[model samples]
Target: MNQTQQMNNDAVVEVLNASGASDIVLVCEHASAFIPTALNDLGLSAEARHSHAAWDPGAKAVACEMARQLDAPLVASKVSRLVYDCNRPPDAPSAMPERSEVFDIPGNKKLTRNDRETRVARYYTPFHDRLKQVLSTKPDPVVVTIHSFTPIYQGIQREVEVGILYDQDTRLADAMLEVETGTFVTRRNDPYGPADGVTHTLKEHALPQGRRNVMIEIRNDLIETADAQTSLAIQMSRWVADAVTQSKDISCRV
Candidate 1:
């Protein structure tokens, strides 16, 4: 709970290493599976509440490790995506989805406009505002959002180990892709892409600012263990650092 700040009564966002010197800013939009006590776990079973539909498993651990290794500030959401997806725009249906994969969200099924707006005002705005505040402090900040994908989605198994995703700007993604990852299978937007509304965070925060950014998706199984998260973080830290250096060089010439 260290470095945790109560952005609202629900404590929607938590920041780590806020004064870190790295130009990179780490974000975990799906960092937690906490549905406010009042939401009643979004009417989901305990199993469903802890499932991938609620949050990106192991993503926060990876992001935290990366922040430590990179000396970068990490801003992460403290509420479940099922309550309100921090990565999505307030207008997007998926922002407050009634269903995720095969699981229907009872609490969200019949939401009125007021219900939706309340969630947005209470959860979404504060999370993004904190993220913005962190990024604003760094000159030419590079945004790196960490996420984890289910190995089997809708019963289909995915083979890609890691995904380097970008919207309009690919400077960081491209450079990271060039870094050899040894056995890890990395691609540019494999499990999800812009079509899946996975890049909303990048579009909203980094694109408008013209900051170098990349959304990284790792298979949840890859980081299922704490040791694995740390190992991956160490490797990713090197790759991201190298990529950031290359991106800055490219920006200087532009």
Candidate 2:
């Protein structure tokens, strides 16, 4: 395999490694450190939303560890979420963010259809296609997309340790509640809502199939450290394993 193929064949995105344990398939659409070379930082300062937009700072570590522990496959994006959010639909505003928090991305503003197509062809399409390909190989696997949120966003304090986001898959959500019950304090879609469409991966693939699926959001502050990442991965792995067991009755809608 060539370099690109080698990378793809090995790591899940540019970060996560596909697991070989459970039937669960994990996705981290924001796991990346890449800012497209053509955009040249998208006209923002090095510190301005770079870490957040480029990647979920600390999420990849936990995601990688989770893949390892669960022995499940993962499909993640190699490009920055700011370039084109893999979780969002092709037309969502955040799908091509002009302003993420404090930084204004000039390159993303007033995108032509061709420009949009370039990003889609380059990043978005490949990611989703890979996801579909992975799922096709697995049989009714529980889809779990991992993401991390800033501890504080736009001056708002987010207190939830984890957020279980889903539109319809109550099985995995209920299982998560049972696992983390009274312990870690998981919010049922507190930080963000599914209607926003920023997290469309679960919606597009997971929920439609009536598969046991949930997007787990860990506070970025909690998993930035290696020890914390490992701990969180182990905890999440147990819940995922439980959810997999519980999902035996889930009929695929695909």
Candidate 3:
């Protein structure tokens, strides 16, 4: 365990239902908006800390509910994405982004190489390592990363409610999209695609190992309330269960 002490104190990665039996493994990379007290909120305004740039609101709730519903394990990052985006590789510029959307992060502006590396070690590495460890417990696990997208980005309004994203492997994503849900509009990749470099976690964890995977993004407004979050989680849990069963059936035949 190369876990950094500072990040450990913050509980960088939290695993729920570690011994769960379901083939699905849930991951929430932006589960929280907590920045270390020592960092001074990463030099952002109070409003920015709770914004989409810092964390995916309602994502952790959905992931937790789905995990319970499906009897699956969940691995989530506790620190804010602004401190260190767990989804991104250490080398990516946005891994410790100085600017996110329209907000400038003053703390990240003049970072030294060591500063960046320290963040990676303190936050990113432990989160991913814990996720990997959880996945290693199950054979042929389906990786489903839960995320929330702002309805409007940079003044552009996104109409799609659910975005099921995948890179080269689309087994789980294709299955998910095939599930019938008349309530919300589901698309392959609408607001943020693989071209947007949002598939880092799936690519790093699922792609190389040839595991089934999908990155699900829901509009933040759709799940702004607790009732709405639970409703969406119930709907998503059924879809995920169906997708996992279908994918496994296909794999067995091949």
List all candidate RMSDs to the true structure: 3.0, 2.9, 2.2
Q: What would the TM-scores of all predictions be?
A: 0.95, 0.89, 0.95
* Residue range 47-158, candidate 1, lDDT tens digits: 9999999999999999999999999999999999999999999999999999997789999998999999998888998888888888889888999999999999988999
lDDT of 1 at 241: 97
RMSD score of candidate 3 (Å): 2.2
The ten-residue window of minimal lDDT in model 2 covers 8-17
lDDT of 2 by residue, 161-225 (tens): 88888775677776677666455768888687677564588777777666678888888988878
Clash totals, every prediction: 0, 3, 0
Give candidate 2 misplaced runs (Cα > 4 Å).
Answer: 1-19, 250-254
> Which sections of candidate 1 miss by over 4 Å?
1-10, 252-254
Please give the lDDT score for candidate 2: 0.76
**Model 3: per-residue Cα lDDT at residue 151:** 95
The per-model lDDT (C-alpha) reads 0.89, 0.76, 0.89
Candidate 3 per-residue lDDT, tens place, 1-254, comes to 34566448347889988888997899999999999899999899988998999999999999999999999999999899999999899999889999998899998898998998888888988888888888988877889999999999999999999999988887888788877466788889777788988999989998888888899999999999999999999999999898888777554211
Q: What ranking of all candidate models by lDDT puts the best one first?
A: 1, 3, 2
